[model samples]
Target chain A: MSDRLAMEDRRSSRLPFPAELGALVAMALAGLLGYLVFPDDLAFLTRLIGIVFLVLSLDLVTGYCGIATLGQSAIFGVAAYAVGNACLAGLVDPVALLGVGMVAGAVMGLASGVLVAKFQGLPQLVLSIAVGQLVAAMANKLSSVTGGSDGLAGISPGPVLGIFNFDLYGRTGYVFSLVVLVIVFVILLRFVRSPFGLLCRAIKDDSLRARMIGARVYPRLILMYGISGAVAGIGGALTAINTGVVGLDSVSFERSAETLVMLVIGGAGTLWGALIGSVVFQIFEHYVSAANPFHWMTILGLMLIVVVLFAPRGLVPLAVSVVDRIAPRLGGKS
Target chain B: MAWTVLGVVLDAISYGMVLFIISIGLSIMMGLMRVVNLAHGAFAMIGGYLASYALKSLGVSYPLAIILAVIGAILISIPFEFLLYRRIYRKSDELTQILLTIGITFVIIGVANYALGPTSKSIPLPAALSGPFDLGFRMIPAHRLFVIACGLCTALLLWLLIDRTEFGVRMRAAVDNGDMAEALGIRTQLIFTAAFALAIGLAAFGGVVGAELLPIEPFYALRYMVTFLVVVSVGGAGSIAGALSASMLLGLADTTGKYLAPEYGEFFFYLAVILAVFLFPNGLLGRKH
Candidate 1:
């Protein structure tokens, strides 16, 4: 029965060498391609950071951990403001700013975890909105502490280790973000495969069953939620640090919803999917907006509708499925 | 001073009544379908737009335009219910419902933008509602007073429809337990469809009545989504009285909040929403499941 099931899984399943190997190769290749195409790829470094943070955190929460939170953007906004406030107050170091953002995110996540972990179903959804509203309200209220609707301006960072400067083309930003992403990816790859990661997945798949079998449910959820917040915060802080422009967009419900979409588009529960989703969405936004700004929203809206309807499993899963079929034709299946 | 206080209370109550009309339909759908529809506000917006268009563009009278807009909203909702929302019924995954409805909301936003530009459009009161109606000691806008009466009437009518009628009994049964209702020959799918249509219809009705307050705009739906969400959260899912009570409280607080602090009104609304959620997750009236 096991062998038969394995065969069935292989025939239908897309797992080739391993999930980590594929992600690593893809990230490296994508990074290399970015470098090849743009000599100043680092200028767009924030996009890479954004992708990593959005994808990794989303996969951790929605994919691996099975927490489908639409309010991930809330923490992202909070961290962005944290970095913005820090930078405004003369905290110029990128690495240090990152820490501040993560701490802010940790605090916010811990607060929300109380409400999130307690409930299921409608309660969860309602709580997420309430949390988002609270964060946004705080941001708006403290426009004095954090720039109000106008956002913080003239936020030019001093560069990596005080060496590189932020160019107009986004090259430094791209390279810096790529390095961070690679490092984070390596750490995540190891973490997810570890016992903790397995337990996280087990908890997500069936919380009640996991609890029945002695899995510490609440603590695990709280831990992951905080970690995910930290990751999301890092991304937000990176953006604020790199771009030096912090605004309410970070906390807007639209941003949160879009990040979830990006996670869904690339692949749920898979890091590479989040990365791919973020990159695709960013690139799509860049090009689509270039054509006509109004068309951009309508196009994305239509794309979301199509994606939800046809590829419910998201594009990453669909891609792997195709790869699985094609590989066997090229002597992939043994 | 006494008369002024009475006036504030009366205005606040009437405004709350309008909010109740808008929120209760949303409560039913969210309770029964388990879909936190981001598009409920859009249906109300649609009613506002259609009603405004009828009054302004077609030169229809205000009351007649309202009726036309309600009809228009219902017709639009039928197609929306069938094509868009039908697939998501009973789906345990909340993400799908949210994303799908968001997508629908975006499409509606785009359509509204194309049909009725990004700028807000207001519906002029019909001649009858243009002036104020004087009571023994005080006076109120004829339009607002009419809305209050209509809102209360709708609430009562909805009460009968949901609690008293056979359809209501079946719906209540289905909402409470879908599989059991299905086994009992209730046709839960039909109930879902009817319930969805009714939900949209109520939102439309609220839209036309409250047009003066919440104008038709593209991002209007997005802004008010949290407001309705607050109402649902505080009221609990599946209870009309809970929704009514919550909506009235919110309306009164909102009016007073605006009066007390114009700039901080929205900020306080959100703060209050978070506090409410902290206090009641299933809402104030929600039964323990």
Candidate 2:
């Protein structure tokens, strides 16, 4: 076991710097390109950033921890509402609001994690869906505070360091969200490479074996869920800050389902896949709906089916495989 | 207060009947095949739309329209069973099943929206089944009575078919242990196909019958999916009696909650699900594996 651990550590360490550096470069480039190309749609792009965070967080539980959930939106919604409420109550600092969102997410995550960790398979799926719907129903029912279906509006997050104003153009929002995304992404990247993350992967691969090895499975799962919730909350906070409105839809079953779909499409276990899947799905949705407002859903549905059948591991892994075949030949010549 | 209570009870029974008819197919499929047919609601919606179209546009008799609708839905599902569901049955992954079914659901919703329009479609019930029937104490809608009767008949028929027949025996064996059933020369694949068709047919029948309670709309598939799923899960997936009882309980809870607290009705319903799942993870009547 010690030898295997050392070997695993050596393998992970061998390629860590280059892979991490590549991911960092790609993310930065994607942000820069989005800013350059779609200046008019910064708000939409910023919202996508938030969704990507949620999807990545979903990967932490689903991909790494092997917890099949459809209720990550529960924490996301709670965090959004928290941020909105905090803003309403004269807490205008964006950073502070983000902290509040993460804390709320962690609390909800811990609560839900207990329920989720108790069950397995179909029951777990059902429990997650129930939690998500319950949260959405609560948000809708609490009209006085949540603003009901109308949603909380006019959430003005006073600029980053009081310099870049959140203008009509959404430039400030985009940059602010980009910065947070990078920070969270780096932290997550480090976490997923650490010993704790290795234990999570082991648990996911075979919980029985992990348990037999004296690993406390339930607590680890709960902690993973809490961390996941915190990440989702950060995403929710970003959305609330950038969009200046938080609606019941954030907590809806539809959001949960869509986020899962995004995670799957990008690839489940890989962090980069979450980013790619969210971007591709959001972009495809935006363009398809713009082109054919009525039939976009059909097209998207077909795409999902095709993807599931052909590329079950998702587009990122598919791309990686193709690159793997080509990279070796190119390296041989060089 | 007594009359109101009676009213609520009657309403609950009728709603429960509708839910039972719609969700039984899903329950059986999940129990036997271990496939979470999330698109079950889509089949139901398709049945409702087809029946509504035939009644309104084609000027067909209600009974014939319903029969045709069920047949149509069955025909539609056969190809899906062969091409899509058959492929995934071997995977045995719940997430894959969910994704595939959700994809099917999205397609069905889109097609229904395109064909039937986004607006709700109402089935014009025949005059015979439309009016209120007077009892000594209260007047109840004849339609509600019809739903109740149909539901009871379905339950009795299904119970008989599943419990007292050779095919039922084979199906039960297959559900209990597919390899053993196959080894016993049960032809599990054929049974699966037939069962899939029957489940779709049942969904269509329920869709046509329960149109008044659940309006036929483009979004019908997505809208009622969670409710149907909740029913199947709460009822313990495989047991007919469990589905029946759970549907009734949920129906009563939903109706009473809506009456007592309109805004938090859905909230309470889901809360009950959470508690039920925590208490009985395999569902109230689900067999321990």
Candidate 3:
């Protein structure tokens, strides 16, 4: 009976293919579709891809780890500045700039993680906002390095593998960002399913219970924060490389809030929701602003209220539930 | 140097007063309901815009326009309190509350932007309060004097209302423990609505009166949100006296920092907030849960 139970458990866990691989294929297909459909607006789409990465990173901490923060943009902005300034000072290789961004992001994550782990609820929220604002203020004040309100410009990253140049049409940037996103998503998919990830989830469910089970909750959260920061940094670096500029707006409170909104709209904790939310929001924003720049905010605001009131678990989860109800057999094992 | 310091102090006091008026309602609401109303600034912005419109388009007297704005804000908030916020009050999740309030804030901002244009609108000060007044050592703006007076009067009235009245007692009981307050036969929901309306009225009054200091614009709601949050958090969420003191302290620090180092003012301000939160996690006067 024990042997049969072990066999059943293994069968339940096993799949036709690794889930990460399937997700990667689906993501690559989506990228191809995006590229094929909007060849003219690849630049905007590329920028949106970069933002999607930031939102995904936000999900890792706020979603999986249950650390409520509005300062993920702080790390993103810091890494962008690091890469932009480094490139301006002769480090033009795309991979090298990404490395710089990742390191800077990790450092920021560790510092902020300590503060976040120390407090609960409102204090934690206030601290995160303060830290984000502080970093933005510093960046603005240090005009010599960051270019202040004018923004850091003249970032010219070299080709990826010396084959595709960063072009004005954003063709190369689009493919480059898509590849990086897939890589990061796969790594995160694995990370979130690991034993460590389960421990983090347990902590989120109940930190006291996790501690009672001897989980050392604070250190685990801090590590998760650091990883999330690195992911955000990569996104920021891609933005710098794609746009060839980094502005103070990148780290502003507005960006932080917008990312959080996207995460909530997509469904927190579920990784795919991040991408879905960002895509829908950015597309809606683009068209609406293009048509009526003045009233777009009203529409967006109404959408937010409706989403929160009606579908608190977000669109992705709602979609999954609907799919399950429609075809129980097809939804099996997901 | 002494004169400069005096000027800074006076400016800080008047500025702090406006902050207190706008934030007191927020402090009370948070204390009583445990709801983080991020839309508080948006309500204040509406009041400012309404008052400005009354002065500009309706040709109403400044004092009458202020009163009208306050009434209008309360009337508008009543429906929201009953329909939206009423439901939110039942759900205790902080994130949901934050999201709901933020949605309301965004809608307000959008409406303000569409209705009042993106440019800043100023309420025309009456002739009596338009110019400077002669003092022993220096000239002081009459507008500043009026603001200071209003601030003092508001503080006194609010003190009497919250600390010395039966309703105040019920409200405090609700804040301390809602279940117990209700168990004693107090209709906490009614108290919450009344308190919410009162808070909205105060915010509108402050927004109209302090338009000169803070300005009226579409982004006004988002712009002052952090400042208001800092004030309330540092003051201790529910303590009125704490709000007053925190506002003054922050107001002074802000004024002094801007005067001394224009470039690093925000840096120092946020740094101070970080250190304050780190040292006093529950705010200066907040009780640990």
Candidate 4:
């Protein structure tokens, strides 16, 4: 995985500041800008951040690790419901709830990863979908615990770090989610650049070769999937906190499919691509669906087709190229 | 108890036949082209909508409606093949193929909903088939028998086509090795187009015939996508016999599971799928890479 990307990484490393720091700064600026721009829609922005986490986790497995998963929502939904139930059972502390969510997500991720890591290609894809559907079915059938199709509601999470109570305007929630997003993004930036991440990439590029060379491919894949699940779980926990509800749709096939669409639209295999893709897709959808609710799917479909035809690498890379063309000095920075 | 058991078996067989019919096209396409065409269900939905349109709006006869739906769907799919699908065939990325097809599915869904309203469409059966048929043990819907006959006929015809016909020989050769088939002057592109058309046609036929079991709505494509994919994958992507057996096995699991425990019906169906896929990672009869 990093073999194809090592050149770009080295070039960016020569820049004045580290690429990761720049991305963190950029995310902070964007989060603040979004806050100022959409004060009324903070709820939506918070949800978008949660989705950004979902897409990032998806990138870890699908984009970086070369796993084709359409069932990532299982991890996300599992953590979310876990947090929701924990809240209902009197674990209202937002930070602790997030921790609970991560554990739940990692457990579910590892459980599914055990089976999913065994296959590759189309079978792998089908297996992931099966796992996702199985989780969803369980969620639906165990209505007594999960609240089933009706969803778990009334989950009013306590304030951020025992201060900044979650208000109706969602100002606190928005800021809290942004802070967590930045933290997760920074950690993930380091995570992907680490030797372990590179090994995962090498395995993704050719597991048989990696295995021949003495790499324990299965454990690495399973571990990466577990980490990915934790990330997705945090996102789910955020959703549960922000909206005070965890519906069956959280674990639905559609949710998983939509997450994939967001990842692809952003461009897979890159963290910035994941973040940019989810944010752009969410904002684009926010406006487009608002304007033409009936034809939103058609518009989105056309946009996706256009992207596949012309910008197969996704919007982030596409934007990067245009910026590079305009400013030769900035070309190497990205 | 025996009568109920017999009823469940009969319903499961008919339902499985419907699954076989709808999913075989997807199975063949996935096996032959390795395209992962999620839009396959969109074609089926289009066929159902067209058949319903012909039945209610045009007041066409039942058989005529089915014929019109199949032809119309094929015609509708030809452009997609040439313009969109042709470009996609060159790409090796499974993600790209999946995304493109999903985009196509969304477009079809949006258009269907916008043009045909969100309400479900029913293909009112002809009087002859609408009534129940008497067997020695039980009276079953005549439509089930009709669907079963259609499914069996499709199986026999497909076997004859693949095993006996020149076209089938070329198709098998292409599936076995596309480059080798092309080297032998088989015109693999033309073969693919024809096969694609055949797949779309079969999907239309299934959509119209199986509409009683799986209703035709704008969201039909996305709703039953997993089910179809499950059958094709379980049966083995390219193997007709694999698909037939998988469909029947899944069909039995789904029906009996529902009978045994209504709430856990989907659970048993998916559980069976996981176990089957686990047991046969390449599918029960899929070719080893």
Q: Residues B1-289, candidate 3, lDDT per residue (tens digit)?
A: 9988989899988998999889888888877887778889989998998899899999999999999999999988887788788877634666777778888888889888887789999899999899998887689899999998998898889889889999989998888888999999999999999989988999999999999999999999999987887888888888888888888888887788778889974887788788888998888887765
Which structure is stronger by DockQ: 3 or 4?
A: 4
Q: Global CA lDDT of candidate 2, please?
A: 0.88
For candidate 4, write residues B144-197 as lDDT tens digits.
999999999999999899999999999999999889999999998898888889
lDDT on C-alpha atoms for all candidate structures = 0.78, 0.88, 0.87, 0.90
Error of 3 at A248 (Å): 0.9
Best by DockQ: 4
Q: What is the interface RMSD of each candidate, in Å?
A: 1.9, 1.1, 1.1, 1.1
Question: Candidate 1 on B37-79: residue-level lDDT in tens?
Answer: 8789989999888888888889987768878887888899888
Off by over 4 Å in 2: A1-16, A330-334
Better of 1 and 3 by lDDT: 3
For residue A32, model 3's alpha carbon misses the true position, in angstroms, by 0.3
Tens-place lDDT per residue, model 4, A46-94, is 9999999999999999988899988999999999999999999999899
DockQ values, each candidate = 0.61, 0.74, 0.75, 0.78
| Regions of candidate 3 where Cα sits further than 4 Å from its true position | A1-12, A329-334
Better structure of 1 and 4 per TM-score: 4
Which lDDT value does model 3 have at A170? 91
List per-model TM-scores for chain B. Answer: 0.94, 0.97, 0.96, 0.98
**Cα distance off (Å), candidate 2, residue A277:** 0.4
lDDT of 2 by residue, A210-285 (tens): 9999999999999999999999999999999989999989998888988998999899988888988998999989
